[model samples]
Target: MMKITVALLFGGKSTEHEVSLQSAKNIINAIDKEKYELTLIGIDKRGQWFLCDQEDFLINGDSPKDIMLKHKGLAVAFQMGKDSEQLICFAEKTFTKSIDVVFPILHGTYGEDGTVQGLLTLANIPFVGPSPLGSGIGMDKDVAKRLLRDAGIPVAKSLTYHQWEQPGINFEAVVEQLGLPVFVKPASLGSSVGISKVKQQDELFAAIKEAFAFDHKIIIEECIEGQEIECAILGNEIPIASAVGAIIPQQEFYSYAAKYIDDQGAAIQIPADIPKEIAALVQELAIKAFQVLCCEGMARVDFFLTKEHNVLINEINTIPGFTKISMYPKLWGISGISYTDLIDRLIQLALERNIKDKSIRKSY
Candidate 1:
């Protein structure tokens, strides 16, 4: 068996850069060493790519280093050959390699917002996760909600605003419709970054302004008075939805600090303590939403279930956080797929997608 040269792309010019690095470290540990010749490619928060030797996190006692170590930093660019049979990466003065497939273990902004996917698409290289179109739509919360609602999926009622748009115009109008106690989020961010819960009118404007700090587009959603649920979806043609899991956040809502920094901040309730019918519905909606948005490799669908048992699709994460403790992996683990196996399956799906994509002719 030939070993594939897999480039594990991690970190980026996004607020989730640290989270991405953490995910990449876990992924580097899980991939089967015999099948893949893995290379660690780290993109700094400034968007510069570096070829690193120490992909694993350095630990001394309980303290971990702030960033991964780099042995060599390369300024690299990819170009498609005339034949289209191979893709080339040119790095600085004297380094080049053919990428068999790109396992982009990246999250948010340039990494997950389809910018990197588009570049890989142009080079015709096989990469993991959803395609550029799917990723782009998934990153934009407003567009994702619209598509999910169109597909008969229930989504929380919300209003979207861009940072440049004038404020103080009809704040009451939106509040009156959706009511107080809403979720303010940056439309294109992930990992619970730049998300806030606004309960009073006085904090509404400030919440929106803070959300716009991360992304130009912001979504304000009516807070559902129920449980927070998440479902993991995987595959290409016929995707599989994992068992649903419930989140019990220590804070009022799942915040960045609660999600990562604090260990006792949340508890994962596997198979979600919901009725069987609701579990079935969550799985069904997970698959439907995955298909609705053209997600291929993988995604984690989050929802808000009200006291009345109303299931509102919250959002879809194309490149979800994948540490051993993340909901995406934990939910799937409860569904019987081990972490190592899930990583292997995602790589296989990437190869299969590459074969399928190459079958189409760009120039007739």
Candidate 2:
């Protein structure tokens, strides 16, 4: 049997580039070599793609702040080929590697916000994770919350503001509506990048300014007092949710540093110490949110479970972290699926989804 060729894409123009690097590294290490042939494709901060050598794909150091993509690999470009999409390396001697699928281990911005997904969709390539529409909906917190709320899913009260509307943002008015301790975050980012917890009136504008630096739009959400719960979702038409997990952050919140840099950032509890009934409800809501958002393949649905057992969704991460300590894989790991098997399942899901999509008549 011929092994499937998988182009593992990582690193990107997003602030979560380093996180993506770590995810790619872990995936490469855990992926079954006997079943899959891996091709490393690294995207730099400037958005250039390269055909990276698996052995020398990372540089600087392992620390999230210092880690960087080794750009020494041959620059590559994705183009439409006679049969399908082709990744061509531009060097003294040109090379082309046929890819059976793409595992884009990228997070945030261009990588996660449907740009890359759109490109792959147009190139007629099968990639892991959600479709382009799903990715877009998942990345934008403001849009996601609206959809979830409309579907009768509970979510924290929040306000969305674009960069142009900054001048008219009244801190006092916002406080009156949402109360103290609001979370200011870039609408389309993840891994806790450009997120700030503003507890005081004086801190609100500064937090908004910080969030605006990362994105054109920002969302200020009322701080929900509860446990930070996360559930992993898998499959397409009939997705299943894993056992609910909890995150006990050591810091004020799960900041970017705590998530990626700090070793003791947070304590993860598998099968969160909640009632079995609550766990079932969490799983139910998780699947509902996954379907409501049009997510397929996989996603990490985050929520806030209050003392009263009320669940409020935080956000949906289409390409959640796959790091050694990341919650997405860890939750599934505890739910009877090993890391390598989880990867296999995701690849199979992507292939299945692609076949289903192709069967749909494209011609009007």
| Top lDDT model | 2
In candidate 1, what residue range of length 10 has the lowest lDDT sum?
56-65
Backbone steric clashes in candidate 1, count: 0
Candidate 2 on 263-333: residue-level lDDT in tens?
Answer: 69998899899999999999999999999999999999999999889999999999999887799999999
Could you tell me the lDDT of residue 199 within candidate 1?
A: 82
**Runs in model 1 lying further than 4 Å from the true structure:** 55-72, 81-93
lDDT of each: 0.83, 0.91
Which candidate has the highest TM-score of all? 2
Q: Kindly list the per-residue Cα lDDT of model 1 for residues 1-364, writing each as its tens digit.
A: 9998888888788887777777887787788889888867778766777666653333231222254434355655566643243433345555567678888978889989899999888777888999999999999999999998889989999888877774653678878888888888899998788898888878878877789888888888888898999999999999999999999998888877666556678888998999999999999999999999989999999998999999989889999997646888898888999888998889899989989987888796
